[model samples]
Each structure stands twice: as structure tokens, then as C-alpha cells.
Target: MASLLSLRARPAPRRHRWTAALGVTALALAGNGLLAAPAAYADATASQAVDFPTHCVPPPIAGIPPIDGTTSAEITVDKAAPKVGDTVTVTYTVTKPAAGNPVDLALPADIMTPTGKVALGGAQTGSVTVTGPKKNPPVPGKGTFPPFSMTGTFTVTAPGSITLSPGDYNIHTSYIMELDTPCTVTNPPAPVSQTIIASPQPGANERAIQLGTASGKPGERATVTGTKFTPLADVTVVGRAGAAETADKMTVKASSTGTFTAQLTVNDKATTGIVAYEGTAWNADKGAGPAAYTVIDDTPAPPNGQKLNAAVAAGTLSMTQAGDTVQLTSVDFGKGGAATGDLHGVTVKDFRGGPAGWSLTGKVTDFTGPGGAKIGAGKLSWTPSCTTKAGSPSTCAAGSAGVVGSAGATLASTPNGALTGGEFTAGAKVSLDVPAFTAPGAYAGVLTLTLT
Candidate 1:
């Protein structure tokens, strides 16, 4: 005769089911070895029980060990190791033996892993806190009861290591006794899952820093590499002209490295074409897929000259053999060039844009100097060549002065000595002398101001 059923009802047994039978001993698995259904069956039923209190009520009797009356929890989970989503917390303990009465702990909605589910108390129920038995007093028969604590919170979404394999899980709760009085149930047998893995520490696979061209001309330089690059920090590598965060910017930083290298010139006045090199694979996160590398130079530029500010206000560049009447200052052609100051004294201005063609003006002249020394009148306006060449050296074959046009001469003798001959009018200005041998130093030439 074998019987193990626990399913109380009235006075204090809203839910509790535990059935067990024993006597089969060898049915192996229905291959027919045990023939007629009993190899010494007196009464048997190994394991099969479920159904417990639907909601509230489960805390009384601490020690554990009660089948139907209620009180039998053996939940346990050390560290299943998580990764998929990762979140674990399970601790259980309920011994039994002190008195009896004071048990109420419930947890078992299928535990997890069939389809996987967890969200019991949010923030993971704080981490752990489900205790029972701060006080139990109701002595009567079979002793022991006064300790019940449980804590379970899991999250691992798809990815094994929890316990070892096969879904892996553990956590079963039950214990109840207050209200009408019945308490006497127990559980804790099939549970001890496993499976959680992640152990990396292998070897090599990372070496970058190679940019061939991403716009060049100004200073013209672009060549950086990477082999064993031990550079800790300071490898900026930024080349941007437009698109992706605004700010026409350019940066290049590299303090040190192994296969060693660092060159990203092109600032000699770079305004050529497609410019974008954002290869910042610096600290290493594996970033530098496709952001920079679009540099093209048709190469072929030089030979530019143009200056115009024609008379009306007053202008004169006389040196008819006697000598002395030059105080222009500067005006080189093509490729940007212009330098002349002082307005309101007559005028003296000149400039020329380069890369292809440039021009600017202002010239109100009147000088004397050959010993006569006069120079008066003012009005000079033309000094725009802060110089942003946009990448120079556009080649230069045969003649090579490549693009030549000149006009520069200085020496108005203003501090008070003599030759006030840096002449001007509308306002008053100065600067003269040059053109004798043409090479002494100041006389580059390129002035064409026709402001009628």
C-alpha cells in the first residue's frame, strides 16, 4: 500500500497538491519488460503534484516539512551565470524545528524557461527580500518551525550557461498556516539548472591608420599608417571640409607610434575639391569605415595678373628719365598678391588673388623725389591677401616665373627728414623710389586700377 497525496481543503487549505506512489521498480520505460503493469505493485506513484494557493497567504511554520497542511520549500540557486539579458538573484533557506505556526511564503508561477519569462517585482524586487518567521508560537506535536526566507530574480534572455544546459533553473516556494489552521506541505526536489559562458582572452586582430589622400594643396601632406601602433592617446586624425556635424574643420594629432608615421598637410590654402577625412580610429572601438578619402587636384594653375583703378580722382606714375616717382608698395599677379597702405593722403593700394585669378585696387598718386622731394595726397584701399591659397604649387614648366606680374617700391621718408614724395591728395599718403636696376629689392609690379 503506497500513498502520498497532499491536497487539503476546508478550515485552512485553499491550495496544496503533492502526490507520490512507489512500487514499480522496473518499467524501464514501457518497452514491455514489466509486462502486465506491475512488477510487485502494492501501490505506487512516483512524482506528480501541482496547484497551490492562487494568491496571498504563505508564511507560518519555519523549519519546513509538512505535506498537505502546508510548509515545504527548498528553493535554491547559487549563481546560474547570465548573458543574454542578464539578471539573477536566488537564495533560499527553511530548515524546520523550533515550535510551529508562522509560515507564509509563495513563489512558483512556472519559474522560467519554456518560453522564458521574468518580471515578478520589478527592479528585481530590490535584489533579495522574502523572509518569514520573525516569531512563531504554537507548540503542538512534531516540533520545529521558525525560519523561512526566499529571494529570486532572474533575467537572462536566450543564451545558455545557467547551471550548465537544458534551460537551467531552480526556485520552488510554498508555506502557509494562519487563518483557519491546516499548514502542512513541503517541496524541493527537481531543480538545479546550469548554462552560462563567456571567457575571452585570445590574441591579435587590429591595426589601422592609413589615409592616402583626402584633399591636398596648402601644405600638401597625407600619409599615416599602422602596424603595431602602441600609441596610447593623441592620434586625432581629423580632416573635414563639409557634411557630418558642420564646422569646416581639420585636425591631425599623433604623439608617437610604431610602424610610425603622421602627415596630413594641405593647408597652404586648400579649397580644392572633395575634402573629408574623418579617420579617427584613435582609442580603438573599430571606427573608420568610410568617412575620408576624396582628394583630387587637376594640377595646372599659375599665370594670373590684373589691377584696375583708372584716374578721375588723381593718379600719376612719372619717372621720365630724371628718376623718382614710385611709392606703390606691392602688387604681384595671379596666385594672390597685393600690399599697399595709407588712405586719405592720396592713395596707394594693390592686390591680386591667385589659384586662378585675383584683383583689387586703390591708387591716387603724386610724387617727386629726385632731390626735388614732394609726395602728397591720400586715399589707399586695397589690402586683401590674408593668404588662404587653397593649396598652391600648381606646377610651373618652361618660363617658371609661372605667373609673374610685379610693382613694389618704398621710401617716402616721412619721419620728417626729406622726400615727403610718397604723395597723395583726397587724404594724403607716402612711399617712393625703385626701378633703377629693377632688382635692388622693391618693384614687383601689377597695378591696373581704372576707376574712371
Candidate 2:
């Protein structure tokens, strides 16, 4: 008969402190022949010595009672058919009998491709949840095991760049349950599997046309480049100038890489501002949309000159304390470059004893200092009011203001010769061309007026 090797758990016996002493006393008595042998040892001779095994023995295994529980799991995916770079969510609901001890649950998943297996991103180790006592009544057909439910979620992502062939692939979900009583049950509920039908991704549908320069004049050359058209297709690019289609069109065959480049000549009579171009591919679905280039007039018309003037009357001048000299305040051309006032306080004295003709001439010195800044003499201009009276004190007549002329030009006397002092008043205006690079400061100059 064969010997059976059975493994079981048993308790250890207690040892007393007098056990070794008692064993030594018994052996001494037997050696001294004061003790008699029992029936079980009757076969042994008197000189025979008893022996015991000295090797160490291993501990027995512990046994635990079987847990009365059952487990089931169901899995669902968010999207059945997903495109490349799309996210697919996997949701699992697992049911286990509620027990006082803790239990562990695991959900392992694998993504299948046509070639091999692919990895998912989130929660590979799964989750665990503890359930309290049941509240509601159990269903009629279901067993009396009050069920505890646990839900776990994980994600599977499809890659963007690679294209997968159209086919049905299976996503398998595995479940495992373990109890704290050193026992595990693995009735994984048929490995809840779902099928995903993967289809070949569609091609990109984007088109664009670009110009080397956005703005150009008539007769200038502009480079045009078109992208994302159909490969190896005949592309017709047309340039339209302001409300006129079919003005300029060029046809070129696209390369194997779906791109083309060409040069367009701006029409000689192209209207100024935004010209458009469009590209169409022959027998293909992709083409460039309308793109614009700015067409500007190269030669613009010149601007007309502007005339500025200011008026001064006889009341604008003031007489000096000596009474022999009459002075007129200078017309100030400040940062604004213009000023206007009436000429006041002019003393009309008998110079030649009789009514004599007088002439007024204005000469302007060069504006100096403040780092040698200067304005042209011709920029200073004046228009003088004339009177026909030959008396000592004559007032200027209405509508006697003359046309403005440059102060550097000689002021002609009244009646084209000389004035008999009807109080000649002049209106002055200055037109300056201040260069952008000039230094900033106050510039002083002299203006000498002589009346003879």
C-alpha cells in the first residue's frame, strides 16, 4: 500500500520546566536496575539503549472556513466605433456578496489590434470598494446573497498617426476576487468582451494658396504657391483684376507631392487695390480657395501747394517814447508757424514838411544761433494795405488789402510808386519748412523795415 502525505494544521503542545529532570531520573533508575520494563518494551534486552529523533519539524498550515459569496461583472464601452485620436471609456460594474471581512477585486483589460495587443492609459491595477448591509429587498429570481456593487473606469486611446485596417477587434475584461481569509475565488464571469469595428481614417481636406508679397504695383512680379491640391493633377490658377474675370489665368500640373509654385505678372492696367486669385484642380476633390494680393498705383498724382496768410492793421503798431520813431512788433511764428494781429500805434509825422511819397521795404536777417538753425527768407511773406490819401494822417480805405506775396520781394509803393502815408498797414504770414532732423530750441533773427 502507498503512504499518503496529508498536510494539515495542528496546535503545539506545552513544555514544563521539570520535564528534563524527570526524564533524567527515569533513565538513572533504569540504569541502576531499580525499575522494571513494561510489556511494550519486553522485546528489548536489558543492555539496549532507547533513542529519539533530533531533527526539526515544520509548522502545520492554518485552515480557514470557506466564504459564502458569489461574484459577477459586466463591462461597457463609451464608443463602439471610434476614429483615430479619439478616447474610448470602459465602465465595469461588479457585484459581490457583502461580508464582514474585506475583499479585493481586480479588472485587467487588453486592447487587440489587427497585428497585436496595444496598451491603455488609465487605472491598470483596478479598484476596491467595501459594501455595507443591504437596505432594499432582493429580487425574486436572484439568490438570498445581499449583493454589493462596485464600479470601475478606465480609458483606451486610439493613436493619431498610424492607420488601422477596417476590422472587428475584441476588448477583453478579466475579473478576480480575493478574500482576507487567505483564500481567493476566480469565477471571472466569462471575461466580458466587447467588439470594436475600426475603419480606415479619412484623408485631410485642407487647401491654401499663398503669395510671396502681399502688395505690388502694376507690371511687378508676384510668386504664387498652392498647397494641398490633388497630387499629379492639372491645376488652373486664375488671377482676376477688379471685376474682370479671365483677365489672367495660368495652368500647371501639380507634382506628386500635391504642391505647385508659379509666377504671376501684374496686369499693366490692373485697378489699384486688392486683386484675387483662385486655383482649381482637374478631376480631383481638393483645390485652393480664393486668395488676395494688394495691387497699388506705383505713380501717384502730386499734391497742390497751400497758401497761408495773416492780416495786420495800422492800429497794430506802437510809437516809441522819443515820438520820432515808430515800431511794429514782430510777427511771431512760434512752433505753430503762424500768427495774426492788427498793426497798432503808428505816428504819422511830417518828415519832408509837405506830403512826400514814402516807400516801405522789409528785409529779414537769417535766423541764427540755437545750433545754427535757419529758415529761408522766402518763407516769410506779407500783404500790405494801401491808401490813396496824400495827407499827414490818412486812414486806409476799405477793400485796400493787397494779395499776399513774399516779404523778401520788394513792397511796391502805393500807386506802384510811393506812399503819402495814409497809414500803410501790412498783413504778414510765414510758411516754414522745418526739417525733421533739426535740433529743438528757440531761434532768434532780425527783421529791418525802412520807410523812406
Candidate 3:
């Protein structure tokens, strides 16, 4: 399903659904030995004094005058400190629109959804648009427009402090003249309305580096292996023969497993002793560390060239995910809302080749509304599946259908055995079932996935 760049509720056939405009509060990763309780967002609330120019869309009729006003917004965020890549909710409450002059108006209370953009600065740049839950009260002759609010969500892409300030906004009136007002911020607040610090994403990949041969002659070809490194990052490996001389520079990209192999000709002039291999990455936290190799004298080879060989170590078990967001496109009263697409697969690799078994489970927090109303977690469910990779056992089974809530529900399990040492991907079709009487608004929920 195609995702809307931003959702602003217009006159639609659906009557009771609130557009999902804001990010959910918190997300936790579960299971022992895994990073737990990593908050996905930072919580904050602030009121800023602001001034903007209102472009009151003129009506077709000659008698009615256009609407204009100066305004300020109170900004609120649910998470105070979030991890990078996590989505967070941002809300804005604006002071009432003071009319340009007095006039008679019949404003529709349910149809006109406010839309606008909030400027962002500091660690993250760009704006979050507000287009959501619609409500407007009718304005009697010379009467005041009440305070109005809008909500939207943005995913934090980097780690550091972010500053949010009020920006352009709009107000739509469904009166006889169809007057709409669009406001542009001329003088933004001195200090930003909301500032949240974001921490680094948890469970970053980094593991022991490997080399094809522990000892090899100078100017020879050798391979390097590694795991648990950042995925899809560019890596450069260098071989140094001595304190003053460099040997070779080989560059390659990390595989999905965060693994890479770079083969280079050892520097011909490299001192005949020990050589060091060092790796570096531009985008990841750390690169494969340095390793040592021996360079031998230029001895003549046997009838068949001497065999260049090395023993490999037992590998470690690891799990990886493709991405972080899940989307549920529409919600209804009885049928609720089903997620639009299949979750990106979470893969588990044993590589350990041992008898240890593993299990993956998931649970979700209740869905929360902007006004503090909630749709319970029990309303959500999923249909799960697991598929084995080339070397994986055909035995790991996907967990049964899950009614996700506060308690844990199994997602996939591998039984204890030697054959259990395989790789597989687990995924689900997540959904929500909202009650008819639930308040209409965009709701957010946290999903926690755990493995052991």
C-alpha cells in the first residue's frame, strides 16, 4: 500500500476514523541478554510566543470580509529522549484565531482539518506537518474562534539534540463563503518550543575480526572475515608491514550479516617479519579491529607451491532486523484496522553449530490517543510465519496466531538439537480491532520483540 506523505482529513466517506498523524510513545526490546527498555522518543512540553502573517483566502461573495489573526502554539512531545531511527509524537496547540473584523459565519465542526508545518533545527532538520482530527465551532457574528490544536509524528534519524519551533499553519472554514486562512510565521520564538536529545540506536553490531591465514609471506593474497558489523557500510582494510611502511589498501562493503572479505597483495617491500591488518568504516561506530600476521623469508616453493592455510574459529549466534516501522493503513469499528504490509523479516542465525535452541517472542503496549484515551493492546493480533534459509534446519516453527498485549506471545521457536543450528526469517501480519465506542483519533502503540 502507498503511504501518504502526510494525512489531512478532508470530506471522506469514512465517518469514525482518526488519521494516524503522530508517533507512538515508547518502544521496548525484550528478552534476557538483549538491550531492554530502550525508549524510542523523548518527552517534552513547552509554550512559545510567536507571530505569523495570516493569508485569509478571500470569499467569492462581496458582502463578507476575510478572516485574519496572530497566533502562538504550545508544543508537546511524548518522549523526552529517544533512540535514533525511532518515531515520536509531536503536538501543537494554537491560541484562538482573532478575526480581522466581525462577521456572521457557519463553520462546520467536523469537516475542516487543520494543516501546517513546524520548523525543526539542531541535530535533525526539516518540518513535521500537522493534518489531523477535524473539529471547528461555528462563529456567530463578531464572535471569537476557540483555541485549536493539531498533531503529527516524525521519525528521529540521527542522535543529538533537536530544536522544534512553530511555523506555517492553516485553518479551513466551511461557511457559505468557504473562507480559508493560511498563517506564515514571520517572527518565530526566541527559544524553541521543544528540544529533545536522542541517544544512539541500541544493539549496534560489532564482533571479532577474522583472517584467512594467521601467517603468510609478504606480497601474497589473503582473505579477511568478520561478523556483527554495521550492515551495508563501506569498509577499508589496510595491511601495515612496519612502523614506517604501508602494504595494501582494499575496500569493500559489509554484507547483510555485517561481514566482509578483502583480499590484497601484501606489500612487496614489506619488512620480512610481522604485518598488521587494520580496518576502518566511514558510517559505523567501529570497524574490524587490527590483527597480526607473520611474513617469512623469500624461500623457494616445493614442486607444488606451499599451501597457504588457516584454521577458522567457531562463529557466534546472532539476530538482525531489516527495519523499524510498521503501518496499519485504515481502521473501522468492528473490523478495526489491519496493517498494510507484511513486517520486514527478523532473521536469526545460529552459526554456533551447537545444541542450543532459541525462541523469539513479542508483546505490545496499549494504543494511546492524543487526549489520553486508549485502545487496549488486546485488540491487536497477528498471523505469523517463519522460513528457513539454505543451511537452516526445516524444524523451526512459526508461533501460533497471537493476540498481542502486555504479556509475551511466542513468535518463533527452535527446538534444542544439533540440527537446530540453522538460519531463518520470522514475520507476521499485525492488526488492530477497535471498539465502536472508542474515541476517534490517531493512536500509537509500542511493540516489543524479544529473543532468547
Candidate 4:
């Protein structure tokens, strides 16, 4: 062997072989993945205007009734190009003021600036409540209300199109003592809907696994090793030979280290060609793998670098309830009175990426008490609410405040296309008016929830 100085003196290409190989490999990769396409709605500013009706009771002067008025809101998203993990600032400005309770007398300056919920749907679900600047101004019998603007910031956690809308709010005022006059958006002839698009971070690399085997003859069996898959998950390996397909479509469980080996049998009728094989593991616990194939007779090698695909199961529309039973807090009716309690939360899971919306309704049977005393279901009322799970495709809205005693009442619902596939929760505050003549006993009623 020559000395180090002598070895260096030998003539060499300015570019090393390893460096050149990497460059060629990178070029090949660029043609395969183009994930940075700009979003369609990447404008500098996105804003929406909505006109809706609200009903609120004016601070009680002993005989005042709830007032109805129209309110306009302008929803604005500050960032034009938002990405996952970015803090996005959103502002809700009252274009037209909502009417407060019309007091018979001048209301004192005891009302706190209002706080409202911002409803979100589409690629993202859930709402964020933000408080406006505190300013209490004395109002004559009838005055403009909710003129303050509120700004809330949320961290963008997922990439997709998310929609934002306005929801219920609470405004408080003092007549004798501080009391809250709640307001709800009864209807929106034209609801203000704004959408923002979030993009994936640059240079995001997903874990990849390779599957393969050397050239083989018709009806031959091959075993391929797979790595970098989910640890201890069940995996299915499928082999295909060009257009003439059907090879070893078999399942194998990964070791604790996430590595798996699958054996495939080449189809007896496989034509001679380069076959492609793909492996997938959709639910780990379920180990449910759907088979897709194209098989071959066999061809030359080194061997083609095959693709290992792991796809999510196209599941059905379903729900998994954690608490199937509920024991409401006991209420003491010292004197004949009404009892109020909250209903337990139920979950909604939709994986059917369809274009249709879904609704959840509750119909309660009449409550029966001791000695056969009966209470009508119409006496029970619920204020509905549906909370969206993070990363849900659409936002769910609360149902109207009504009793289930009718044909049936909506507990919570989502607009058409709201639940392409995601999860949310439905719950409500329930009030029961117990008759004074009923005897004291544990009353029971069946709350039937229907999903369509």
C-alpha cells in the first residue's frame, strides 16, 4: 500500500461517486412527491359577513318581555397562509349590534362586556369563547347592545379547510343584583361562514417501509421481510405480478420491534412479467387488512424497490359510547319544585366520508313515579350542545331549546357535509317540572337517541 501523501496525489474526479449517487437519487424523489402545492384560498385576508336574528330578555323590570333584534357579525382571519402549529388570530367584529333586554327603566352600568362562542367546523371542529374589552355603559329603556369586538387566537394543529361562525352569547346586567340575560342566534337567513386553509410543514418526512422478493416462477412461494411498520401491529402482505396478478396475499403480526415477514404464493396462472406487491395494516387492534393485488411470472433483478402502503380502513358510520349508563345528580324537592341536571355526554364517530349530514335526536318516554304517578315527557326540556373533537371534519351545532315530549326534539346536529369523517360529543342541560302531587320515589324515563 502507498503512503497517505502518495494516495492523495492520484488523479480523481472533482465530484465523488457517493455524492453523485445521492444527487441522482434526490432527482428521482422530486418527481414522486409534490406536496407543497399552494392552497386555493391563500389570499392576504379572508372575511365573511353574516346576518342573524337573536332573542334576549331585557334585564327584568318585573314586566318586560324578551326582545328580538337582528345582529351582523364580520369574521376575519388574519393570516393569509396559515400552516399547522402556527398561532392564528381571528377577530369577531359586530357590524350590527344585537338588541339587549329593553328595560322599562334606565339600566345601570353593571353589565360586563359580552363573551361569545366562536363556532368552528369543516376540517376543524369546536368553538373558542373570547371575552371583549370590559366597558359598562348605562342604557336607556331600549339601546344598542354588543358593540364590542373580540379577538381570539388559536394554534393551527391540523392541515385542512376550517370554517368559523358565530354562536350563543351571554350578557349580564344589574337590576336588583347581577343577573345574566342569555341570548341565542335563533336563525340566520344568511349565516356568515369563513374558511381558512392550513398546510403541512415543509420537509415533513413520513416513515416508509420496503417489501420485496427475487425473481420467481409461476406457483412459487416467496418470503419478504418488512420493517419500520407500527410496532406489534398486524400487517397484511400482498404480491402482484404486473397486469396478470394474484400472489401471496397473507397476514403476519409484527414482532415487538415492528418488524414482520410475510410469505406469498405466486398465482398458478401468473404471466411472466415484473409483479408489484403492497402491504397494508389498517386498524392495528382489529388487524383488518383489505387485499389489493396485480401478480407475475417473474423477471430479472437486482430487484425493483417495491412500495409498502398502509391505508386507513374505510369504516362505517358508528359511535363508541364510553359511559352507556348515567346516574344524574340527585335533586332534593323539599317543596313541590322543578329539578335541573345535565345529561351525560355521548360520542359520534363517522368514517363514511359521504356528503350527507347527520342528526342526533332525543325522545323521552313519560316518567313514572311511586304508586303509578305519571309525568309527561313534555315537561322536560333540554338546552342542547355538541362539542367537536379536535381534528374533526365538521362542526356540530347545538339543537334548539325545546322539550323532547313532542314527536321528538333535536339534541344536536351537523350541517350537510359537516361529518365527512371525524368525531364529536353531544350533551345537554335538562330540566324536569315535577308535579306537586307526585309521591317521592326514584323516577325513571327512557331517553332514546336516534341518529340519521
lDDT of each: 0.25, 0.31, 0.55, 0.51
Encode model 3's per-residue lDDT on 1-452: one tens digit a residue: 01111111112245334322211122321110011121223444444555454535443442655545566566777777776545566677777553421345444456455666666776566676555456766555545556677765665555677777777776666555455556656555324777788887576434456678756666777677767666776667665432223546667787887777777567544422222222442212354334555555465777877856333223445677765444345555444444334565777776543344677776665555534456676876778899888756536789999696767588787876533467888877766666665655445545556565
lDDT of 1 by residue, 182-220 (tens): 331223212222223312112222345555654444445
lDDT of 3: 0.55
Work out the TM-score per prediction.
0.21, 0.27, 0.54, 0.39
RMSD to truth, every model: 39.8, 47.4, 11.5, 24.4
Indicate whether candidate 1 or candidate 4 has the larger TM-score.
4
Q: Estimate, for each residue in 1-452, the C-alpha lDDT of model 4 and write its tens digit.
A: 00000000011232100000011000000011101111233323367678788876655644667767777887777774686534455567766666654555677674555656667666555564444554656776556654656555444445676667877766756456666766778873236457788887443322233335444555666655655556776566554332223444667777787676666666644322221122452222222221222334244444666544232333444543333222233333444445555655667776644334567775654543322344666877789988998887778888999786735688777775422557888777776666655544334333445565
Best-performing candidate as measured by lDDT: 3
- Model 1 — which ten-residue stretch has the worst lDDT? 26-35
Q: If the candidates were sorted by their lDDT against the true structure, best first, what order would they fall in?
A: 3, 4, 2, 1
lDDT score, candidate 4: 0.51
lDDT of 2: 0.31
